[model samples]
Target: MAGKQASVLVQYIAVRGDLAEKWPMGAIIAQACHAATAVMHVFKDDPNTVQYLSDLDRMHKIILKVPNEGELNALVSVLESNNKDFKLWVEQPENYPTCLATKPYIKTEIQDYFKKFKLLK
Candidate 1:
């Protein structure tokens, strides 16, 4: 017998490990927050986002770590090619690319794209 699949929406966040190491913890956390908020604002009208917001308390997100700016750029480029909507947050003045975030998406639909990355530890 086949088991029924569950459709769960997840927000994907990718942060540069180099920045996390070099900067203070609060600064690194701020970058992730900026990316996540930016993506949410950009995709607020999307159905998945709407649904995800409807249950704010239970919303789920998977935070991943990218080794450095090169890896962050590579991930964003792939997301662009696949037409996957995401926000890449760049800190100003300092001119730094810090984090990336994808709008809420069905797990099965986008999970493979992030399979190689590990959860932020």
Candidate 2:
């Protein structure tokens, strides 16, 4: 038991930084939240999601920021090419892409894809 590595599942949520110019803080946050919740619901049956949820207090999520919708869409394309499962949340009425969230994944398996993005402040 002493040598076993710790559990390190993570969910990455990237919100758009450019949205602040046209949207209020509350709406921007709601987009990220919606994306996060949507991914969880979409991938609820995934093994990692099951394990990640097993420990509610220890569940990990990395919130990062994208400069605008373009970067967000580009990231989505990359994820699609890699066959990674994720949810890209688009705001209704405006049809705006605001954020994206990858379902729970083993940290090391997907962390690199997000290195270019900074922590969402």
Candidate 3:
């Protein structure tokens, strides 16, 4: 995977694990938003890319509350852009729903957030 993509994945797993430790929903959402904003900065040259990443991050919060097809599809689109055959990573039954719902959003958020710090660019 690309450096950005790998970073996103690792950060997401860490966040998910942290959230699983009984963190409040609001806190989780805030963290996610921050991460998304950072991720958006990585693609500062393209506003649409930033918007898509932001939206995906927002949708990820929603997905945590309610899993849906559209959100999953959006995530798949983002992942595919970073790594072809990314779906293979999601194929494991244990990882299916959670990864499908959260990975893209977390990645987008992290990128956007870091970008704000001018670290990504």
- Which lDDT values do the candidates have, in the order given? 0.90, 0.88, 0.38
lDDT per residue (tens digit) for residues 4-89 in model 3: 55434322311343233455667545544554454445444554444445545433223232133344455557546655222212
Compare candidates 1 and 3 on lDDT and give the better one: 1
TM-score of 1: 0.93
Which rank order by lDDT, best down to worst? 1, 2, 3
Off by over 4 Å in 2: 1-7
Residue-wise C-alpha lDDT for candidate 1, range 27-80, written one tens digit per residue: 888899999999999999999999999998988999999999999999988999
Each prediction's RMSD over C-alphas, in Å, is 2.0, 2.1, 14.0
Candidate 1 residue pairs that clash: none
Tens digits of lDDT, candidate 2, 49-120: 998899999878898989898999999999999999999998888898889999998777798889999987
Query: What TM-score does candidate 3 reach?
Result: 0.31
Model 2: lDDT of residue 59:
78
Any runs in candidate 1 off by more than 4 Å, and if so which?
1-5
lDDT of 1: 0.90
Error (Å) of candidate 1 at residue 41 is 0.5
Q: What TM value does model 2 have?
A: 0.91
